[model samples]
Target: MMGFPQLSLVPLVGLQYLTHSSTLLSSPWPLASGLQQMGISQGDVVLLLLPNSIYYPIAFLGVLYLGAIVTSMNPLSSVAEIKKQIADTKACHAFTGPENADKLQALGIPAILVPENALSGSLKDIFSVFYKLIYSRCYLALRPVIKQRDTAAIMYSSGTTGVSKGVMITHRNFIATVAHFVRFEASQYEGSSLDNVYLAVLPLFHIYGLSLFVMGLLSLGSRVVVMKRFDVNEVIKAIDRYKVTHFPVVPPVLTALTKRANDSLAPHSLKSLKQVSCGAALLSMKTIEDFVQTFPHIDLIQGYGMTETTAVGTRGFNTEKLRKPSSIGLLAPNMQAKVVDWNTRSPLPPTSTGELWLHGPGIMKGYLNNAKATLSTIDEEGWLHTGDIVFFDEDGYLHLQDRLKDAIK
Candidate 1:
């Protein structure tokens, strides 16, 4: 979809082995056919309640290919949370790990067990739904005509501010995200993007991870090394073993990496890493400095976005002439933003701290089934009101100050 020719090698590396892009892209067809056979149609909601695995991208694309909607949840979520989401979205089916299958089954939802890794041992049942779906020879015919505005996914907000709401993202939102978010960031650096290898430690369920690993980076044909979860030890080994150049992480992971870098006997394991992109949460100034000082050669960039915005907003960029480690850099291309005064609801000028509001194609369609919450977040003019209090400096760099929402006690 990103203009790379369908060929022998495309862009996924899993568990120390290379999986051809053609294989990854083509595997979804059978899955789409299977979903169609199971009465799944366009607009039907399917939940992906699993961790980062090679199969994740396949299942996600498969559901979309069939014109069905995808809603993902953290695999570690309690049954009550899972049941609530299922009810909210009316999810007809779910793809999850074998360990979590019973939870879905107990709720009267069919769960297709996906393996934790590329290895087949994890899926001991050769006749499992995942096995049958992926290996099926029947190809999908008469694919549903998907519109750009059609809802592609429903990602739940973190609920730090309040109760979690399903953020509805459209196909156009994802297309714009890949174009403005992933591709533009790749172009800023000097290298063939196809040569870039990313270490995927962030959970694919999160917008920060999903936008990059599952959708965006693949468009550029960048090789992604998938990890089921983040582990400093395994992350180091993967970077060395796979020659990973790009690492996308959250603040905690960055902090953990900085600490690991300080304590490791051989920091040479991370010599191949070229850049580390941090997001999901704000990074303390101290954390930013520690990472930059520890990995002097690696570019440490912080981004600002939310699930409501489909992870498109401002991104940190460092050049030879300009570098703002603490600032979240500039607004994304084609994205218009405003720093609005909370009390007056008026747009503030530069250097004034207020809530950040963003208007862009990447903004969510709305909170699914919650017109009241959607209207409150997005105004009549269409700017998605990000509750983060931030200010644009004189140089146009966005600096996050605080949040309007009460802190989670």
Candidate 2:
């Protein structure tokens, strides 16, 4: 890949403050050397419990460079929940934000807190031991020759249904997902450099943020502005300040944005935005209509995926097939999808509602350490039985019915 753009993280506190982003190429070796010295070997699982920050990406890449698995945890998770997950994953080392470090340490895990960016620009402000290693140069520390099938990440599913499960996403899974974005940008965004300013407000611990926004944007060398936390006013101001071109968000954020934009006293200044992608929870048709009516220039697209499908499975794309807010767009390239009856397990036709099953290279390796769950999720035929029930319109656009796990029989 070519050299990525010079990245700068615009802090939420002020528009003037900017933090330099250390790319995958130059920063990984030093950090990898440090990790090697710390006894982090290949295939060892490490937990990155952090909020959205420049340091999180660097630490994640460093672990991957050494052929180790990086399992990201929620920074806001309660102590009891964090303990259960750590024990479940068997991760001995954890890198966390300053806010969550103390709690993690109390649980007997080797937790390192990410340091503040002091004015001196010296290593004194950064994470003490971690920054020291970033300066260390060791040729032997580079161990990038990792098998594709090896587990690269253990992503925890958003437990909207019942219980949280750790999903094992492999290196090939990430590579395939990124490759799709690269190809899509090159072909669709022909005149443009495919490099635009990205608002990194989405939590990186989640697969939606990690696989697509973080990994995808970095691959293109786009500038990302990190928000410590999301506030409706702060987001609007950021868009106006950074001229954010693309925003991948959840449904709630969109709903809030629409409400704010409708306020006549404070008009929205989101002219630079080309598109806004939403998923996680189903967005109401009314919200989509209101947002579109308010900002006719912006393309509001919808998508559907899970922690199991890397990040993307079906997403709305360019051309005349646009503006279907109710639909989850189309199946991704090289992706096979089928809709089957809930009880009888018989295939359903287009326009008939049934469970959405998908087979693709983007499917996760499996649920980490849970073979029964994995087998039940992905059958012997390799099709992942997504609990979501959906149907297609006459135009072949997929629309949701409801999630079988949560739907009343």
Candidate 3:
């Protein structure tokens, strides 16, 4: 609720084409309202399988307004994966584009077609523009106070290494994480006069990119360059063209960044770049040092969290505190963290190797449809048992050791 209320605060007025060509093609509110008009309400679930487009934001927010839950999904989900998630969530309706229409139908679920040509009208075009103006203004005036405990989004845990679980995160958890980002990082940025341009190469589907990079940056009014997919050359060119400052890199991209020479990675006159945040997985110390050496002007930071935690918990390299390479910085204010014995679930003293436990506003409500998994992950005391292995140093710096399950017995 910074500037545009529900919209990004980073000024996009100059980059109108970027948004118009994507999200503004059709009236997002009307389309979102159409779903409510069609009968989905709070607590109801809707499965969405649309391509990476402007409709994603529209659909997501619309679901939020109606108090309904959205399960943003990958179109490439195998029949088995799609069926499983849909059935597990007990989704009553689905809105999909032509690409996945047949797949949704195969599930015998009620589906709505979101066609590419749904917004092709000269009269409707004028009306669409007018609709955006009124809706945006109304969104500002009527910016509702989001309840911290209210479930905002139901995300499927990436089943990459195993079975996918649906994680239910409350609006408060996200806001709290954003509060940490603003207090820790964004406030420093806002003090500067230089324009902030963010290159959002991370998929919104991922927790790292979605809340931290997207919502975090946008809330501060930074202009975001959205790429449907992460192509090396394309991202490089955009940064050069836009003079993008922030690039949220994951471990794989961090590896690539360090592997390539500075000249090979150089974008068009990108002097605006000053920081890079690496998350999703651990960034090697070697990579961090190499990157800092290559781009001395850029501050490299690392963050750690999981989908269950709304990507909160810890991050590394606070300028005000002791910056350590292997450490994931200090816990954000208002959040309590403990190191607990893996087997006994009892709190361990600092410097002792144990599983990380987090209790914060950002802790997700629970895993949707998996009471057993939820109970296992979150104890009766309300602490979230992060499957991550870590140890806190005497100075309160959190150092990454290994994942709980990944650690050798």
Candidate 4:
């Protein structure tokens, strides 16, 4: 790790306007000190219910530095869902926005209320004073070291099928996915200033918006504009206001963007956008074509992956490739993929539809607190059973059919 670029230093590189909590700069020391004061320690699960507020980054990284596993819940989660997640993870402490703070506390769980105006005068002043003391020691020779396979975050999927299960994303898995994305950017945005602002309207709780897009962008030094929730009009307004260049979204968002273009609520100067990436759900060929026709100059690419696979397993969609828009491109570099029979686990030949199995560092450790589920998902050799039915073409491009789990018997 000596010569590797420090991911923490990336955001400070080229930022005319990067706005996170005042405490974001309080990392490596103030964070340690604050958590020490709060009594959070390694291996503890901390439930976080913060909005897209600046406080979110501060609280999240603070917990991470303490060796505690952070579980971020959807801000819009119902009271029942919130209660279930807290119980499931058995979190010792919680940090949340005012909206969900009292409700969570009512469950007899301890919590710290992140003030509505946490960025205001008094808090900002306090953070500034602490920031100076922490930085003065040059981080006081902080010897923080995170192991590659240590559990970093316990993420839960949307559970469209059933109760959400915690997905265990290790530091190694995340770093590998980051490495994969860096390889994908080889010539696409090469030599371009990473100072460009990124508009992030996607929910950070989701794998697509959280690990793949936000962390990846921050690791490379780009300003992030986070929207608390997805509002089609607000998203457009933010893009224009912030002059965002790269936009990452889901299918529903892509639809709204096309419908809202050139409208009064839409950004007047959205022509500044360089490219947009869509994931989380299958994007239709008509939607892709319509988007290209509407924006004309913008490059739109569809990426595919599941939470178990650490966000994106593949990314490849160019003009020639769009002839078969169903394909999610090729497996990412360092990723070895094969189609296997769902029943016998026997390897299937290419162009034969079967379950997609992935072997890569980006695959999760397993489902948290569920050994049976873990065994069902990850084999002895560490291949992840994606539960998604897909096949490879003669060109080696992967085309997804439907989810084996989602398919009705």
Candidate 5:
């Protein structure tokens, strides 16, 4: 984390607020001890079917603390879908809520509920004694030989192109992606991190939100306003209530906001907002211009990446350099890329549209247990053929056009 702007830090905010950074950082250890007590072992896979909440991150880290891999799935996923993933990952335990607990129980999967509304008698009662001890000063130190290349998380692909394959993102991938944001990204996201409060409506299970908001924000020592789900009105209210400054959203939200009356939210509700990062789909120029025009002070940054790259490959990290319009800024540090002509399988020149291939530590270990698919995407030379048809301007901004798979048939 960088030396950030001054503030009495609010490290994490959820159904319960843990205002002190030290307490927030210390909370995970006792929880990790509790997890160990549950017979969770190293190299085992633990499923997290949780929403954005205080328990999510702590549980995520605790599993990793045991040298185990963490895989999170959408809580709203169909029961069959959830069952399929649990079998695929061979997850031994799960952290979920009551809404989805019956599905887990019906499947005979042992799941610990992460409750929100009531604390006294809800199913959370089973874990409340353990949960309360999470922030206890009593720290449990279990230092395993955790390597960066060890699989940190397995997030499923959105499956837009094919069946959802589990993407194996490692620990190093997280460090590399966030470091670029803090130190190098157009010098924009640094210094002011402490002053930033992120609206956590994006699903924490999605790599975009997990890496950028949960993991990245915590590493930066910033405040995160956790939301169980995305509600447009709730988002507006939270922004005003918490003085949220950094916004990470999908294209549809950006598009929806363009049609909202200027007065739908109070004039000054979003006055403290400084940046809005859009991804998960193509961001229309009209949407970007509309947001910029309406806010005047806020900068809209669009980025592109896949779950395999840990949700960051190219981003419009620089506030001033984004004037080029329809591009996803520059390649992250330690990353090499090329645009190769599909027909000849040869590299193409700048402005030549071809399949984008990227090589870096950010590349995942591969699709879990799917060696063939992994080999198909990542070549022997460590290049990940992104399958997205893209071109770079003379100034090196990436412009996405289409997916090579979609282009074929």
Candidate 6:
């Protein structure tokens, strides 16, 4: 799936901008050539600091196509946060909007301004850089050798405990995520994944969103409706307008949607929504109950994962014979887990509370440039000690109990 030319042969529609798969495949060549012209080669890092847009996926894929590492940051991040990440990653260049171009320039890093939307006749002058890059005739003559083990991205973990650290994810890790997590989930459904319409409200910088939107679903030829940010009304309208089938969101978004379902006079506003997946945080039983009651037709599920796991943990699935709203489903395929007593470091039996340890191909290489932290998080036995306390039930459903580490948001 490297470069993804073989997988994405269908059309992709984002925010009314319809781009052919061939254009998506070839658009990266000019960008990679441009980066090479700027003297950025394999192993160099490029920062992407922009909101969700069609360009986000192109830029992310382009960086990987060049064999350079990509490190994405929140577009709304503070100047201090941006500076720290840039310094930490040793980024050579950046792709961002005009609002943050000056900030990167002031730090002596070259920045490429990415437009918020596709350029039309009137907006042509306003988005010259983006317009020129995608249409440029330049082609990369020599492609670098990128091994599966080489780092493809450096996504920063949510600095819940302290300052955020970069998690190095390899190409092989992403392949596993697509296979075991994304495509596997799609396979459990009725139709082909390419027929499913996905709403991309989750930020592209997060591993959950990045894994599904930018890499996984794209590889399966799914249509992704990209939003600049989350807005409840816009989300409803988009789902109705585009017939969005699969929506991946966090608990707050789900809660907001549930509230909308309760207040909206038009019951069919979200008639097209087939499944809603919640992650990043736990959903209260009340929230789950309300959602299930309000939208009985839509499948509501919860998943558990972290940046260290490349977002490849358990995912909720409701079958005709079984439905456990509280559990985070079973472990993903090709993945292993163990619930260990935190104090004793001993594995616990079913229904016993303990910290969750995960082992899989999707596990990240390590925290970039932090060997000590990496050693503590991932043990010598290669199990990633996810600091969340959880347990599995008799039915093999994983349930979240509490967090062993302090985390913010």
Candidate 6's TM-score: 0.93
- Model 1: lDDT equals 0.84
Residue by residue across 1-409, what tens digits does model 3's lDDT show?
3432112211222231244423432344455455555666567888877554434555655666666777767767787888988888888887676667678778897776553222445544533532343245232223334465777778888422356789897877778767774435666444542256677767666666667544565555556666556666655566676778778888887666655546465453446777788777787777778877877777777777778877787776656455576677768777899998988878899899998888977788988877888888788989887778889999888888887777845
User: In lDDT terms, how accurate is model 4?
Assistant: 0.69
Residue range with the least summed lDDT across 10 consecutive positions in model 6:
3-12
Preferred candidate (TM-score higher): 4 or 5:
5
Off-target runs (Cα >4 Å) in candidate 6 are 1-15, 159-162, 406-409
Listed per candidate, the RMSD to the true structure in angstroms reads 3.2, 2.4, 5.2, 5.0, 3.4, 3.5
Model 3 lDDT at residue 334: 78
Query: Tens-digit lDDT track for model 1 on 56-95?
Result: 8889999998999999999999999999999999999999
Would you list the C-alpha lDDT of every candidate in the order shown? 0.84, 0.76, 0.67, 0.69, 0.74, 0.84
- After superposing candidate 4, which stretches have Cα over 4 Å from the reference? 1-28, 115-118, 122-145, 158-161, 182-188, 262-268, 317-326, 406-408
Off by over 4 Å in 5: 1-20, 117-124, 129-142, 158-161, 181-183, 186-190, 318-322
Q: Count the backbone clashes (under 3 Å) in each candidate.
A: 1, 0, 7, 0, 0, 0
Off by over 4 Å in 2: 1-3, 15-24, 116-126, 141-144, 158-161, 181-186, 265-268, 318-322
Which parts of model 3 have CA positions greater than 4 angstroms off? 4-16, 20-32, 110-148, 158-162, 182-184, 188-194, 262-269, 320-322
lDDT of 4 by residue, 1-409 (tens): 1111111211122222334323345454565556555566777888877665434555666677767788888777898888888888888888776577678878887776663233455665534533443344333234456798899889996322455799988878778766785435533554543556677667666777776434566556556776666777666667776677778888898998888773544335687787787777788878888887788777776677778878758875566444444567767878889998878879999899898888888888888788888887788999877778889999788887888877637
Task: Give the Cα error of residue 125 in candidate 4, in Å.
Answer: 11
True lDDT of residue 61, candidate 4: 63
On residues 296-390, what C-alpha lDDT tens digit does candidate 5 reach at each position?
A: 78777778878988876888754463474357778877888999998787999999999999888788889988898899889899988887889
Question: Cα lDDT of model 5 overall?
Answer: 0.74
Task: Itemize residue pairs with steric clashes in candidate 3.
Answer: 9-221, 10-221, 10-222, 42-67, 148-172, 173-362, 240-268
**Candidate 6 per-residue C-alpha lDDT over 1-409 given as tens digits, one digit per residue, 9 for 90 to 100:** 2322222111123246656667776788798877787788999999999888777788998899899999999999888889999999999989999899878878888888887665678667756766677788987768899999999999998522555799999999989888999888887888777678888888888899999988888878888888877778878878887888889999999999999878873756788889999999899999999999999999988898888888899999889999897889888998999999888899999999898999999899999899888998899989998888888999999999778874213
Clashing pairs in 5: none
Residue ranges of candidate 1 with Cα displaced over 4 Å: 1-15, 120-127, 158-161, 406-409
